[model samples]
Target: MFDNLVADFERPCALDIKLCRYYHGQCEDEHKRKKLEQKSNNSTSLSLGFRICGMQVYHPETGKLEKYNKYFGMSINDNQAVEVLRTFFGNSSNTNLHNISNTVRNIHTAILNQTDFVFLSISLFFFYDCKKTDVTPSIQKTDIDDQNVQAGFKVRLIDFEKAIASSDNKIHQLPQRIKDNINYGMVNLANIIDSFVIEK
Candidate 1:
């Protein structure tokens, strides 16, 4: 239920809700049409020259080869056959290929976006220190600024190691949001430290 909510929110606005609902399995016939939509999204936007399910017709974008009666009404011939095999064989999935890929892409994009907050935090910290120091520090061990910089660095590093080890499912079964927030925060923090770190 939570995944459904987040997945809905994750989609960029302006995309048709009806279309999204249709794809996300909100309707009664969703299961039946799942394969068709999977084919559509995975391949790319369809053109007028394209054919619908169970019909042997050429798609303008995909040039050559008519879609046969299968996953997307397409045989997936030649090199495409290899790709199709890989997609299905590698996953042991019952869901259509498009849905599978969509889920993965969504997770990936979410994790990446979550990390952006980390960079923002680091950049803000850098500017704060720069204002006091009146200049940027060099990123080296010999160069140091302010008091106990090394202690701060060490504490931050320990915190980092703890965070990563804790976030893993093995050590701690963390919620996705928590994992995302931590990872994003850590990445940005690392970036900021790298910008003007010194080993004084």
Candidate 2:
């Protein structure tokens, strides 16, 4: 199902590399398409390709294939992904509701816009600095502007063995099956976001 989503979103000409080349003819459908890709060489958009179901199609932007490095996608489904996120964020104060909602909405929007490849499973990474509770002397006012504290979030879609190539169509309505799965995934995600409670 995820494969179908990705196929619908990505243009054949957009992917940076035809990851099928790495399969050495072992991959079924995706591998066959590599032949068609050979006829054209205009695609240059850097793409991570697909990696689910133990199948890997990795293409680094640096043009160096790092087979040794771990690929990012985890094998969890939508429900599990939501659970993991809830556990990480723990409980939040009502004041943080807006931020939590915005985070979910942003994720949903990004997924909807990504028509290139279906993501079998998605992974979330939370990065933040340790809270500095110890009181420190405040430096006197200076001309230098300080960089904001660093905490970032990222989403990774993995798994593409079932991926199929399709045309990109942002304006057109998707088939019912695809729409159903997307809606289901979003609902689960929303439930997780709603679970956050304002810490008293």
Candidate 3:
């Protein structure tokens, strides 16, 4: 199951861990609780982009098939990739409607802690588009900060916002922009980052 999710994208590791923790009752954040509901209702393209890539998706209506969006990594058609998404979704549990509305805000807490999903997503893109550019340069600085996160050095995050932005931009290809908005909902995003000073 874990392998399938990882094969679906770049790093389902974080998602696996988050979902695991949630299943075991570990994560508890009101903010995250709110967003998980949103995540569940988010667009197929957004979800698919984070889950797979390198392909075009279409929204099929009663008699029409329209190109929805395009991605550049992994695929819904690959055996391994298909397995991952299936495994992840297959394991999703049922929740109490009352708890979801009163005790908790959404169905799953893991989807809201998005850093893992974003990181793993970068990996999938590389898996499919390794030749686009060297990904190391984009990640090196942040990696150093990740190490210093425990050292009291505030870390700033830039890559995350850009990732979400790029994802949103990719969905504009739909002819009905409002329909796209309905699928994605509102786009107010927060960047989970801190400023860090290196004492070199």
Candidate 4:
């Protein structure tokens, strides 16, 4: 029973970004691990610490919704990740930028505070309203809302089936490599978002 995150938006643009450079778990079968590694290496996940798993954005100019599949995500290189994010956030207005920046900052803070769990194969899901009226030409930095769903933009971390918690007695301690991978992903994502906001 999961709640619809984008139910409130009229025209919601959604993006699924898979975090961490590694996707395989230590306990997985050797064959499956290799397959996951190959998939990660073939996508932006290997080089960028993140990959666009999927996206659906409403293009106002075309009055049509554009859907990007996992194949499109896997084909893109590190150099193209920024442009892909730009498309997701939309270049026509600053509203999305403001909201996304705030969301990223919140995610960063949450990541910093998280110490007992190591998330594996998780994704950051971003959604924002794409209606023309939702676009705001200018917004003061001070007016940027701190809430996750401010201005109809929101981001949430999902896909936690592989997450390892320190409280699990079977796993006496979480491995450092797992922790490092998540930190690496978050840091790289923050840098990417920072660059995108700065460029806009």
Candidate 5:
């Protein structure tokens, strides 16, 4: 089931190797782990974008791909994005709040950076693990003796195949309309993250 597309080769190749390592019990530091989660999520979008641009996805280990957060789950619908964000970060205690906030900020940064290209529509997909988290309405206050619990996050944009450059040569520059849309998206994303964090 592995179809090799010209443009999608690099990202999937790199990501698949890393994922294979992770699955085989290669542990990574927190920061690198967070970054790798983000990268793995984005690799799916890159794959779709390449296909939209007429490149095929090189299929390798379809079963493994289907098992990762990247391929197995459904896309977060517009209405669900906010709820998903809330659930993903809502249950963390104060100590974990900082890391969760950092993850949200990182996601915002990634979205802003990637959406520089014109896009007709974009959606974020949540990780299966994050989706499984129990989001209680009220999180108990952090106790001094409590052990640190860091919940990893994975969220990335999709449906970029409809995306295109505003101009043939100006691939890096997006038009005003696209910029406005991206700004709006980021604002909503930030609001969702803020709604979940219990202010200390």
Candidate 6:
């Protein structure tokens, strides 16, 4: 019953990135904690603070939509994350790096403004039009009024079932891991997006 986010786009491409270094939040079971830890360590979530969970990309050349499962995401290393983003952003002449940069900046700013909140097992959902004709060149001349949806692309934070609000005194009092915070993930994500934008 949920609304389709990419309904407007002729060819939509989407990427789901799990955020934060730690996925489990204060699990009482020791075995479960170790399992979650191992899962995070094996994926880019431990090293990069974020891991690609899944993706659906439309390849114009092949004229088909390609699907990538969690296994493909788990196989990617820190260095390959940038290339993955590049593929998501596309390399068409109509691709706008500034739009991507602005999108990252907006997400970073939103993260910065959110204080005293611990987000666990959450994800970032990125979607855009894969068709070159639907890609807008830049933010300046876009007919769409929403700046967040520039270039027919949008990024949103999703999956809050495991999120811990500041009101949770227990979590606030607990010792925080180095990269367990949402800010850590956002910073790493911004850096990765910047790297891709600069290289382009």
- Steric collisions counted per model: 6, 16, 12, 0, 3, 0
Runs of candidate 5 with Cα error greater than 4 angstroms are 1-89, 95-98, 111-116, 128-152, 169-175
lDDT tens digits by residue: candidate 4, 1-200: 36888787788788988887866466458887888778887887878888888999998778698888888888888877778877776543445565566566666667567788656656788777777374443323442222444455656767756676757763555456655566566667767766666676
Per-candidate TM-score against the hidden true structure: 0.17, 0.35, 0.20, 0.80, 0.37, 0.80
lDDT of 1 by residue, 1-200 (tens): 01221132221111000001012222367666787466434531121112112222222233343323434523332244333323212312222223323332333344355532221011011001111212222223431211122111101111111234333444244334433333332332233223222211
Error of 6 at 182 (Å): 2.2
Q: What is the lDDT of residue 113 in candidate 5?
A: 65
Clashes of 5: 3
- Give the runs in model 6 whose Cα sits over 4 Å from its true position: 92-95, 137-149, 178-180
Question: What would you estimate as the lDDT of candidate 1?
Answer: 0.26
Model 1 is weakest, by summed lDDT over 10 consecutive residues, at 13-22
Clash pairs, candidate 5, are 2-59, 3-58, 3-59
Q: How accurate is candidate 5 locally (lDDT)?
A: 0.36
lDDT of 6 by residue, 12-39 (tens): 8999888767665678999999887888
Model 4 ranges with Cα > 4 A deviation: 92-99, 135-146, 169-175
lDDT of 3 by residue, 4-67 (tens): 2124332221211011001111138867765644442342324432323232221112322222
The number of residue pairs in model 3 that clash at the backbone is: 12
Better TM-score candidate (3, 6)? 6
Taken over the whole model, the C-alpha lDDT of each candidate is 0.26, 0.32, 0.24, 0.69, 0.36, 0.69
The 10-residue segment with the lowest total lDDT in model 2: 9-18
Model 3: residue 184 alpha-carbon error in angstroms: 4.3
lDDT of 4 at 60: 74
Please list all clashing residue pairs in model 1, or write none if there are none.
67-73, 68-73, 68-74, 118-188, 140-199, 141-199
* TM-score between candidate 1 and the true structure: 0.17
Q: Whole-model lDDT for model 4 versus the true structure?
A: 0.69
Model 5 poorest 10 in a row by lDDT: 14-23
